[model samples]
Target: MKPENPLTIGIDIDGTVTEPSSIVPLMNESFGKQLRYEDCIDYNLATVYGISDEVFADWLDKHGERLYDVAPVHGAADRVLRQWYKRHKLVYISAREARHLEVTIKWFSRYQIPYHHMDLIGSHDKLAAARKWQVDLFLEDRLENALQLAEALSIPVFLFDTPYNQGTLPRLVQRVTSWEQVDALVDQLALEKANA
Candidate 1:
């Protein structure tokens, strides 16, 4: 079956549109430990940093605002998203706390990244939001989220490749290294949907 007009695209904020390694410097500075993005083998920061969940949460409480406010957008994300906004419904769905919505919106405005909707779900589970929006495709950075969403929605998930998410993916999940590749894949998917 063909997708509807103005295909709804569910996108992640932190590591997808934003630089995947943006938080490494902040973590190192805050924890007084040397850690690299390449060293992040798992999605859990507590596990990656060898800290308890409570300690990690405390650190975030102290510095999460500044860390998110200054995070850089990924290369070509602004340009590509602006173009996509004209033809597709760009819905940003993130696990960022709802309290950060103001700063998050500010960041988007500061970078001038286009979007039709934004949902700060405060949890890693995004299937609810994806289903609510009827998202046709998902762009993500978390490996498990991508796989889960693909299985739930039976839709293609373009996972922005990062060290934490490096692993084998399901058939519906594709690892993408750049926004340009994302653009190309979206076009290809749209074309296929159109022809189908």
Candidate 2:
């Protein structure tokens, strides 16, 4: 069946909209370690950096806003999101805490990223926010979040492929390699909805 007009699209900010490796430079600079994006086999930077969760949390407390401040936009996200903004309800549902909301908004503004609404739920579990927004579809980069959202919500989720997120996905979760692919998928969904 066709979805409602102006479909609410739940979008993750860090790895989905920004390059998955966006924090590498900050990490490398702070830890004095040279880590490539390929080296990040786990979603947890604490594991990748070989630090305790507490230490990692402290570092994030210090540098989290800065990290978001300088994160680069993922490939073609600005253009494609702008296009989608014309027709869809773009709702950025990020795990970033409310404290970082100002920085996040500034980052979006600095990059000219379009959005109809944004929420920084401060946790990795995005199911609540997604459901609250009544998202028809979701875009994500974390395998766990994508899986949970799809399975629980019974909504299609586009998972942005990353070195850390390598895994088999369920039927409702599709691994997308680029924003271009995401755009194509969105277009296909729109066509399907139209034809329905």
Q: Taking the tens digit of each residue's C-alpha lDDT, what string does model 2 give over 1-196?
A: 3335567899999988998898988889988999999999999999999988998899999999889888889999999999899889899998898999889989889889889899999899999899899998999999999999999999999998889999888899998888888888888888787777
- The CA lDDT at 107 in model 2 is 87
Q: Write the per-residue lDDT of candidate 1 for residues 1-196, one digit (tens) a residue.
A: 3336567899999998889889889999878889888999888899998899999989988887898899998989999999888888899999999899899999999998988999999889999999999999999999999999999999999998888898888899999989999999988887877778
Taking all chains together, each candidate's TM-score versus the true structure is 0.95, 0.95
Candidate 1 residues lying further than 4 Å off, grouped into runs, are 1-4
lDDT of each: 0.90, 0.90
lDDT, model 1:
0.90
